[model samples]
Target: MIAILKTGGKQYIVKAGDVLKVEKIEGEPGALVKLDTVLMVSDGSNVQVGAPTVQGAFVEAEIIEQTRGEKVIAFKRRPRHDFKKKIGHRQHLTKIKIKDIKVS
Candidate 1:
């Protein structure tokens, strides 16, 4: 089975046993997270697509770790203005493994 779920202002395509990184979620390792904002679910031929989100459908996942993404550098400069700025950023992220997809 395959499913599309939403979290942290983003959407993802996933299936059971798949591991992925998403925006930081508040939980410790091994925490079970239920994602109820499912956009679509499919099992080969049969597909269910929600208007916004599927009712009574959810995906379960286990938090594997909290991590940070690769650093991104932002730099700005002005010609002949003696102005320069440089900033670095790393997005907080969560590693999660999909456990199950269920529709009621």
Candidate 2:
């Protein structure tokens, strides 16, 4: 089965055994997280869509690691002003593997 779930203000299409990187979730490695904001689910010829979210539907995932995205550099300068600013940032992320999708 395949499912669409929402977390960290984003939606993801997931299936069993799929590993994905998403915004940071508060959990340690090897922890199981249940994502219940399921928007849609499909099983071959049958499909189910939710009105916002499907009731009793959830996706189970295991936390693989806590990581960070690549650094982003921002630079600003003013001509003839000798003023410059440089900044860098990296977003916290979590790597997870989908274990199952259950639709009741």
Can you write out model 1's per-residue Cα lDDT over 1-104, one digit (the tens) per residue?
99999999999999999999999989999999998999999999999999998899999999999999999999999999999999999999999999999999
Model 1 score (lDDT):
0.97
Worst 10 residues of 2 by lDDT: 44-53
- List ranges where model 1 is wrong by over 4 Å: none
Model 2 C-alpha RMSD vs. true structure (Å) is 1.1
Winning candidate number (lDDT): 1
RMSD of 1: 0.7
What does candidate 2's lDDT look like per residue over 6-101, in tens digits?
999999999999999999999999999999999999998999999999999999999999999999999999999999999999999999999999
- In candidate 2, which residue pairs clash? none
Candidate 1: minimum summed lDDT over ten consecutive residues — where? 51-60
Candidate with maximal TM-score:
1
Give the lDDT of residue 71 in candidate 2.
100
For each candidate, what TM-score against the reference? 0.97, 0.93
lDDT (C-alpha) at residue 59 in model 1: 97
